[model samples]
Target: MKSENNYERIVQNSKKFQHSQKNEMQKRITDLLQQLTNGIHERNQIMAVSLLGAIAGHNTFLFGPPGTAKSLISRRLAYAFENPQYFEYLMNRFSTPEEVFGPVSIKALKEDRYLRKIEGYLPTADFAFLDEIWKSSPAILNNLLTIINEHIFKNGDERFNVPLKALIAASNEIPPENQGLEALYDRFIIRLLVPPIEQEENFNRLLDSKPSSDKPEISEDLKISYQELAKWREQLHKVKLSTDTLLIIKYIREELAAQFDKLSVYVSDRRWQRAAVLLKASAFCNGRKETNHSDVILLKYCLWTTPENRETVEEIVMHVIKSCGFDTDIDLAELDREKESLDKEINKELYYSQDIYDTVEMGEKKYFPVLATFKDEYYANRDKKYQLFISFNKFHSQDTFNPIDEQGNTIDNIECQFDGQGSCSLKLRGNSYHNQYTPLTFKPKIIFHKGDKKLDVNKRLIYSLSQAVSDIRKQLIDILKQVEKKYEEYQQYLQSPFATQVDIDIAVSGILDQIDKLNLRIKDCERLGSLCR
Candidate 1:
């Protein structure tokens, strides 16, 4: 966020020199953070936005490990606001409220009313940071509570209200034993988990950025005005919330609730509220009246607060949030069932058809006892004309042919033709080459033809498939709309049980089954139709 192109910083410097409205504000910060880590579990860039909004007022808590960019990135980001008023405190047992709020003003003591005079410190300045906030005792946290909320430092019994535009606090961990940690932690709406730099370059940057004594300065009026901060707040309220979006949010909450019992984790309401704030903050930055789909680019902080909860939040967004209004369990189940059935059908065909031609060759054969003989229409011709007639493959050839004695002497005259009679010819090699055929037989076309309906059915099926695909796309769109609208709501569950992930394994299995069965059926239909033709 600390780039040379920071127009916000330029405007602030301009205000110091009182320049004309150049409209030369550069792009907002967080470009790299967004580009490199766009939606890694949906934690919004709160520090960046809050830092921008709160030149008049902003506070944050970056919690995680020691090497996480807690103080490093936050301090750098704070510099863009008001030439950077950096007030850092490594909180410890000895840390006093005055160390953060600033010592009581010696000059104000002369006045009748007691007020802490700030020559130069946190009390008079704007941007501040507190490192290892929870390492300090409850007394310190208690002292900070009033200062953080009221923007005033209390001395003895008197309080001095100061202009605190922003504060970036940090903790090594979200400790369970810390008695007052939760309340103190809640003050930081922009709660981010900073991790050790994964990229070697960022780590190098951190090591190279050693503490420097150089100071940057500008006139007092260059500081951000309360009016502008108020405008941001006002502008946030005007953002719209669509009904479809609300439905998506509700669905996400329901999903979270359903899985809470299983995961043994809960997403608190406070986190949801904080997510809403972040959503608005992002909307404010984009110059949008309200958040749209594209704004989710970095606003995931509203959803997740810890590294562990990031997966859960991500599932809600990438799967559930992305797949809104769609539950394909039935389609999947049916497809699976069809696949099983088709497998069995194919397996049943593995056995080849037993020879039935020999059994039927006997005169007037009744065919094999096991094989069912059904009446099938066969081609037969009356003089120069073809007519369909029921023929039996089960005739008893023994009765139709002349009886033969035990000596194997045949009495019937049989005709054998070669080459459909090469126009009607026969061989007479047996019986001393004297026997031959005389009558000629004709063959008829055996095509089973009817009105062609395949084209119509194919067209209908294509239309239906297209319609189904359209329905699927519409459902997906509706879901995305809901997610876009309830982005804050979706984020709320990211770290909570309500933000549970869809069973990827199950979903993938089901989808694969559907595709496989659909392909199989399509293949079978085409094959059968071809064979029949």
Candidate 2:
């Protein structure tokens, strides 16, 4: 069970030992985001998610046109960590490996072996940024792919582990083709589109706002240290995802394939695994033991491989989330997905146990006109004698009739068709239609009286399923309330004067929309549950 005051308890404990440690993680993160995006508005999502990704030790890519603060934001993130060895580089196709890794070692060259000097460069940086990252030559990109992924710098015959923490890469646009850059592109897990300000008010603010104070140099007192981050990064593995979140993920993957061409949006197995880590990191940093519905939103940043696929991925994720109720768990989503199959299975079972008797008379010798007997006699014997009308009373108890064929089998081939009035047409499947017989006159016999036990069983099963659905619905309602409360808190914090550096309307809107979707899903669930009856 999760403690209601987990966040407070954790913060209070951390404060006792070191107040700045736990408290400063979020504070410094928000501060850096604000400072870097001061004049910017409506892009709080990029800043917030980017900060989370950095905290989780995942690299980020900011793609947009020039003057969108990509470089500024990347630089501010480096400073957010205390005393980081920050490295910034602008790469081009002509760029040589020495420029990024380091100049060829003068001492190593004397020994007739190839090597790069490793000091005050990308090889030693705790935080680094590469502008126009895809523009780098293949040699630089290949070396970068290894360094960024494994933190190892290879020079000559020696391999040294680098001290890098997180690397931020900026791009004006994604590379048009893989061209051997697929591996490098995949390394930057958190890809974001840094579109220019959308709202007019934000644009006006950008024009009138003063340039941020000189980008602060790396300062140990203000930065989040590797030790501090390592503590939570390890905790990320323990963060659990609720069943609803998993179902939503599964549904998105399925929907993406069904609705869009596979080539347009392809997510690799490795990327999904890493993306889960990012989600876990988000929940852990938020003081939760398990991920909630809101954490699923982080996937919007992870799944999109290109700007073209970004909006579609977001819509897919959000739509899945909206279709699930706030209280939706793995069990509930499973039930929703398997509803049709469940109904079919239940109905099939009920069919086997279905009542076989047609009449209500019980424990009494009651005679009923055999439908097959009446039809056979009426067709075979009626041709000998014709009548305008025949009363059904003679075919009842007073008459001795054979309801079985000469083969000693019960007449089971009897079938009837009602024609509006208190009358019906009875005929055997193999029997030829007689022009003289307009409609058969006979009372249905009580072959054997039996209760509709299968019907009762079906009702019971449906009722039980309905109850389960109702329980899940109720849980979802409660969960919805919790999400709403959290959203309100975020809004209040955003509205506070001290924290009014950026607008999170878009972020908050996405969250609110998710909440609304939960409600819609809950309603759908209710309707589905009621269907069991």
Candidate 3:
């Protein structure tokens, strides 16, 4: 009884935890996000996700044409941090390493040492944006890979720990294939397509509004400090991936593997590790202890490799996420198999497998024979061998049948009309021999299980089957309750500062659909249970 009370207490605590309100940190983050994204039209998703990438210490890539506000979004991201050292550069083929990393130090050059003054450059900045990144030469791109991946820049013989929190890169086109830029490209895990304003109303608002500032007026209290960011990064590692999120990831990997030939999409183990960090950071920022389906929906932006396969990869991710509902910890597949096995056992024990009927043998064919009483009394006094025999099919049918001899030969001038009440009238030799002829002892077959069985069979099999169905019904009801509770908790997910409303809706809708499916399963189980009675 004490253990039962403890279990109840645990359940109540879990319910409270699930429905808890957002914390102060989450509220501040939400307000900060709104300040950063204010006056931006149709760019909420990109801006919000970019900020998330920054908070998680992941690089971002924006792919689109020149006038798509890719640079603007990157510039606005620095405003989220306090006094961030921001950097911006446009790359071309003629760009040299000295121009990007800073010109070689003249004072150090006289000492026969190669070194670069890195002040006011990419390596020293906290947030950087490189536009037209693919246009740069290999010399600049190779060093960039090192900086973005390890957060370390080597100036001559000395390596510096770069303060770069997030490096957002923008490009009009992806790097050319076989150019050996794939490694550098893979470092940017959060990839988004920054397109022009899609809706006409938003576009008109953009046309009417004045040019927005590169840095928005965010309050100092709202702006994240370096100390806070560092502390949050440490705390982000503690955010666990929930079972549902892991299941969604596994399903996505399986689906991608299945479509590898057509999609040519491959996600590396390192990339997955980085992506998991991003999801954990999202959970942390939202004041949750674990990731959920809402965070899993962000994989659509992270998994695509190129613009061509972007839609296909997004479809694969969303299809997997939408198909997988909340985790109920019950094996539905095992329940279905058990139900099937029980059905087969019930059929084997209670119902006949083949048709059952009585017939009389005549040569190679079988017929049903009946006794006839004639008005002439001549045939009635004959031996039993003179009894009328008809085909089995004709005996069961309502049609008129002719009588046959004991040798299976049809006898002419003998017509019989069955009254469908186990008796028939006969006309013998064209004379009115109106007599009632009753059929022989015959019983039709019983094949299906209509719950009519012997007492022992019902006690042994049907009772057990009904109990099993009841157990399954209980399991389904439990799952339905859990899913319904998750549906209620969706409002908390919607309050997340990182995930967009559209994404939250998709995840919530997918999980809510499971409630309907679970109710259907419970009803089917009830039906199965009723069949036993």
Candidate 4:
């Protein structure tokens, strides 16, 4: 008894924790995001997502027309960290590497050595931003790829690990095709299209409001320190990818493959690996030990290569995530088949094998034949010989139906109505028998269950069916409870600074729909079990 009481207490405690769980990390992140995006119009998602990329230690690329506050976003992102070394530059075709990387060292050059001063330049910065990045020469772009990928800078013959955290690059257009920039372009995993203010109210608000500050005053407590970031990165590796997340990834990959001819989208394995890291970091920051479906939604911002395919890729990802709800190991199809089989077994054991309707055989066709009596005094002694048959579908219907003869031909001028009891009435009408047929009641032979031998129907069979139904119902109820718990946990995602409410709704709607289907199956099981009782 003590052990049982202890088990009950454990279960109760588990339920309590599930309901009251709060993600302190997510709340802090949300507060930081609000501070970062203060006074920004229609750019909250972009700012929040770019900050997420920075926290995840990944590069971000913003693509749009000029004057869309792309540079301002990167500048504000630097304030999220303590004493961030921020660097900004605008690139053009005529620009040289010295302007971006820093001027050459005069003393080193005098000694016949080639070295560039790396202070106050891209090499030493913790966060960097480049505007019109596509116009940069191959030399600058190539070096940037190394810094973004490996955080390494080569000055003269020595290699030093750069302190760069995340580089935010922006351009009005994509890099030219076949320009040897694909490798560098792929380094920036978080790609976003920074369109102009879309809504009229937002556009008006943008025109009416003052320009947002280049560096918002963030609280010191909210600003992440290098030590905290390093520790979080270490913890991020411990975050596991849930099975539902992996299934979502697999489905998206397969769908992209199937549509490759139409979509022309190809994601390299390296990019996928980086994307997984971003998801893990997301879950870690959101106070989750494992990546869930909400984190998987962030893949839409990571997988697309160009603005043209961005919407398509997002649709595909959303489709997969919405279709894959909480992964419960219950096979509803198999359960349905089990219920149907048991129902058939019960009917076979208890009900008659032959047709319930009284049928007469005529050339391999069986039908019910009835008679009609004349009501007219002129034809009172005359009884009409009419062949009558009830349709297979009319057993439960009250509608009048035409009678068919042994040859399966409709006997005109006669109508039959089944009362849904055991009896039916007929009406006759013809030139000779007009208004002359009395309604005749015919009782079809009743077919009952094997009443006398019901005891011999293997009590084990009925008991087994009942037990199966009970087990199925219990399993379904358990799965439903799990789904409810998952939903409750998902409520925490509403506070997420990265994912949108629309996407969360799509995922939750799909899960609820699946739960509804499971409930219907449970009802079917109950009905099936009743057949035996």
Can you write out model 1's per-residue Cα lDDT over 1-533, one digit (the tens) per residue?
Answer: 32333334333433433232212111233332333222222223443444543532446667777755466555555544445456777887787756765665566665645554444667666667778877777766776787777777766576678667777787777645438566666667565667655677655665676542223232244333456666766776666643423444676677767777654345568656555555555555544455433233222444554556756765664454343322332343454455445334332332222322222223442222111111212322211211211112313221222222223344233322324221212121223333322333322222222322232234554454444444433443444444335432322222111111223222222223333344445455444333222
Candidate 4 matches the true fold with a TM-score of: 0.75
Give me the candidate number with maximum TM-score.
Answer: 3
User: Ranking by lDDT, best first?
Assistant: 4, 3, 2, 1
Tens-place lDDT digits, model 2, residues 1-533 = 12334334333433443332333334545455666555556666776777788877789989898877787777766666666688889988898988888899788888999987768789988888899988888888888889988889887899989988888999888865848888878878898888888888878877798875436544345457788888878878898986656877888889878866743787888888888888787666655666655577678788887776788888777677656533432354564566545445544543343324233222232223232333343456543222111223323233322233333344444444434443445544444454334335554433333422244455666677667667667776776777777654433222211112212233334455557666776887666564555
Instruction: Give the winner by lDDT: 1 or 4.
Output: 4
**1-533 in candidate 4: lDDT tens per residue?**
54354345434534554355457898788889889988888888998889889988999999899999999999999999999999999999998899888989999999999999989999999999999999999999988888877789999998999999999999988888999999999998999889998999989988898988998989888999999998998899999998888889999999999999988899999999989998998888889888887789889998888778889999999999878777777775687787777766666776555546656766555556665454654565565676567565565678988878766788777777888885677777756644466667766775543432254577787788778778877888888888878766665553356887567666655666666677777787777667668
Q: What's the C-alpha lDDT at position 439 in model 4?
A: 64
In candidate 1, position 358 carries an lDDT of 24
lDDT of 3: 0.80
Model 1 — TM-score against the truth?
0.50
The TM-score, computed over Cα atoms with residue i paired to residue i, of candidate 3 is 0.80
* Candidates ranked, most accurate by TM-score first: 3, 4, 2, 1
lDDT-wise, the better of 2 and 3 is: 3
lDDT of each: 0.46, 0.64, 0.80, 0.81
What shift in Å separates residue 210 of candidate 4 from its native position after superposition?
Answer: 2.6
